[model samples]
Target: MLTHPMPDPIAFQIGPLAVHWYGLMYMLAFILFLVVGRIRLKQAHIAAAGWRYADLEDMLFYGVLGVVLGGRLGEVLFYHPMYYAHNPLEIFAVWKGGMSFHGGFLGVLLALFLWSKKAKRNVLDVYDLIAPLVPLGYACGRIGNFINAELWGRVADPSLPWAMIWPNVDQLPRHPSPIYQALVDGVLAFILLWIYARKARPRLAVGAMYVLMYGCARFFTEYFREPDWVVNVLGWDISAGQVLSIPMILFGIGALYFSYKFDKKAAPTNVAKPKQKHAQ
Candidate 1:
């Protein structure tokens, strides 16, 4: 029997310039990434691989671009293409809020690829380095979503403990799906991935594990969260999030299989061995 906090989306106003909690949450997410990345840089095994703090800053720059652009575009193209087609200029009005995690994920991949090339490092290696650090930041983003009262969950049984009523939506109790996602997809995933990524096993395994875990989490959570859109496939009312996650699940499985089966170096260890140091 909990009520949604429905806090003001705007954090503060500064003479015609307003600061928002959503923006602050994103800032926090980036800050967390840098902080965790710094810790990763200091890890004995990771440090031996020639990871530097400056490199992380450079990657962060690329990541910001990727998240903003990719998330906006994904929202437009995947969720509401027709709407955006009519209101084309609204696509750039990111401050009004619309972003897709899948899009941001793809954006990060592209950003990582570009960073890997410029840093002359193996792309998979870079992915492995950053994968574990992502979940906590994701949790923050979900918190932002909750604060904005956007992406509210589907209807829920009133009898259920912790069932919440989002005043913006309706009087019916609904699952606090954002919190669920933050816990399962963000915190829990972080714990699992952090442990998995601790000692390197294979080239693509860590990154693949991230994809697999997130895909599974999102798929499971979609049942509770309200679908932004749905498509009927073979008479199945599948969610857009679920549809996007299917390919990720497949790719994760494929990448993991490839990592272990093809890469002779694949092995469990307490201390990760350094790969060939690429020119920076």
Candidate 2:
């Protein structure tokens, strides 16, 4: 871990077109998903749903909308409803900052539901296929947060090597919550979900594990994250991230349970077997 005070957000500049690292990170996240998703789709389980490589493009296109719109909306509604109500113009200034992970999660769910209906595909099947590819993008998002240095962490002991002293906050060393999230949510999440999804059995497993795993990671990680300035409630001392993660953990628990219980239902018993399109 080198300490050069986290790089500046700018990637490069083309006259007035100044490219930000945050934006670049999103592009990279999506590319990683595209590359990984294409390979996974060809697997026997995904093939059951007849997802072609082309489908990845269409599906991810919808996801982009979900992430942007839902994230921005979630921030406004969940964290700063009162403030935004006072300053309506700030709601449109997403590039400046403010987005909620839970909101974006909801957005993607809706997008997938619509995509499933239009494609005549089972909703769970698509969810399972897409779950593994999500972590990389999420990781990239955290990296963006780090670069912006907006979502700083709680106060920490100076002896803490990884403790970051965000001048905007106090000089005290503090946990770099974004980095922790990137490791847990981004790196660990991708590895675990990808390995688990290789076979793609039990459609519920993928979506459920995604909720469970990310929720757990996020909930725990939120402990070190600083509270949003907008909400300074007493006693709880918990951040909004932790509150949002609770539902995800619950949903994950339910999903995994059903996946196990219904594992027998999707079996090839009189019901039609999944078609094999790719002979290879």
What TM-scores do the predictions have?
A: 0.92, 0.87
TM-score of model 1 vs. true structure:
0.92
lDDT of 1 at 243: 96
Model 2 ranges off by over 4 Å: 1-7, 229-236, 265-280
Model 1: per-residue lDDT, tens digit, 1-280?
A: 8999888888999999999888898999999999999987877778888988998899999999999999988998889999999999999877656789999999999998999999999998899889988999899989988998888899999999999999999999999999999999999999999888777568888999999999999999999999988989899988988999999999999999999987867754478788998899
> Total clashing residue pairs per candidate?
0, 0
Q: What is the lDDT of residue 255 in candidate 1?
A: 92
Candidate 1 local Cα displacement, residue 114, angstroms: 1.1
For all predictions, the C-alpha RMSD in Å is 7.1, 7.2
